[model samples]
Target: MPTYKFKYFNARGFGEVSRLLFALAGQEYTDERFTQETWPAEKPNVLLGQMPVLEVDGAAYGQSSAIARFLARRFNFYGSGDIQALEVDQVLGVVQDIINAMIKAFYEKDEARKAQFMTENKEEKLPLYLGMLEKLLVKNGSTGFFVGKSITLADVTVFDICDKIQAMVDFDKFPQVKKCRESVASNPKVKKWVDTRPVTEN
Candidate 1:
């Protein structure tokens, strides 16, 4: 077995997906969590000066989605074939788009512009993405999984993002999306982690 060390901040942010993947796979890895006070000292040593670096046998890799995909493939959380992989990637891309918009609004400096961005997000983008995801889940037979008959990286990724979104807005209108989120959370290992993991404000 490869020795694995994942470094990230105390918050779930981008690191949660990889952590969830590890838990779901029952993989043993060193989770190196930092705080704001500790991050600056450790930042320069990080592979890309970014949190959530996955070090495999002392070799460091950057990018959260890339790390998640690597773990997904290793643990069979990626789907069975090339087409399924593509479908998973497509969902991931859409999730990233949603995340990007949220991040932009989060960091916006102008108060009026921020409010505008947030309003547009709440009224438009959120529904648009949620509806699209709902359709994808339906297309996949609404098995509560995104791509295949079982859990995949796509399902976990979407679940994580939807959970975050739900913190800001209710997802009651998106029943399929709600079911998918519930299914991921209901996984034994994942539920354990969610119940016991360190709490953070992210």
Candidate 2:
């Protein structure tokens, strides 16, 4: 087995999904978390000056999605075949859209612009992306998994994002999405991680 070390901030943000992937696969890795104060000094050594870098043995890789995908494909969390992999990628793209909007709003220095971003996300982007997710679930026969007949990286990724924005999304309106998240949450290994993992604000 390759030795793994996942480096990210102390917060869940971009790092959580990969961590969830590790948990779901029952894989072991070094989870290296840095704080605001420590991160600046470390940033220079990172290839992309980003968090969520995955170090296998000594070689480093960058990007949260890339790291997550590597682990997912390695652990068989990616869907079964080519088409299923496409489905998983589609959902991951949607997730990236949602997260991009959130990150944009989070770092906005202008107070009014920040509020507008937040408002637009709650009123617009959330509904749009959630609807897309709901439609994808329906496309997959509403089996509570995004692709194939079992949990994939897509499901876990959706669960992590939804859990973060639960307050904004109306689950009653998106029953399929709700069901999918619940299915992932109820997973034995996933539940253990959720129950035991460090509590963060996200």
Candidate 3:
């Protein structure tokens, strides 16, 4: 078996899904976490100077989505087959749309522009993407997952993003989406990790 090392910041940001994957799979890996103050000294050594990087048997790989997908595939968290994988990817894409909108709002410089960006995200982007997610969950039989009957990369990604945005977005109308998140959160392995993992404001 290849040894693994996952390097990311102390926060959940883009790194939590991969951590949840590790927990769900019961796979043991070195989780190397950094703080914002300590990141600069080590940033130069990281590939592309970005984090949530995974090292497999000493080989470094970057990109949060790529890293998460690779881990998901390795741990059987992707899906059963090609078609299911496509479905999982579709949900992942929608989650990315939400994350992108959040990122835009998070980085806006002008206060008024930032508020406008946040408003648009809350009023438009979230509803569209989250509604699509809820529909996908319902289409899959309302099993609290977007893919097959069990949890997949799609479910984990949705759960992670929803946890991040729950405070900012109203999920009362998206019951299925809430159920999907609850399903992941209530899982034995995932719950264990969440219970023990560092708490972050994000």
| Model 1 lDDT, residue 75, Cα | 96
Taking the tens digit of each residue's C-alpha lDDT, what string does model 2 give over 1-202? 7999999998888899999999998999998999999999999999899878999988999998899999999999898888889999999999999989988998999999999999999999999999999999999999999997788999999999998888887889999999999999999999999999887777
In candidate 1 the C-alpha lDDT for residue 61 amounts to 97
TM-score for candidate 2, residues paired by index: 0.95
Give per-model TM-scores: 0.98, 0.95, 0.97
Worst 10 residues of 3 by lDDT: 163-172
Model 3 Cα lDDT, one tens digit per residue, 2-51: 89999999989899999999999999999999998999999999988999
Ranking by TM-score: 1, 3, 2
lDDT of 3 at 102: 93
Give one clash count per candidate, in the order shown.
Answer: 0, 0, 0
Candidate 3 steric clashes: 0
Highest TM-score among the candidates is held by which one? 1
Error of 1 at 56 (Å): 0.5
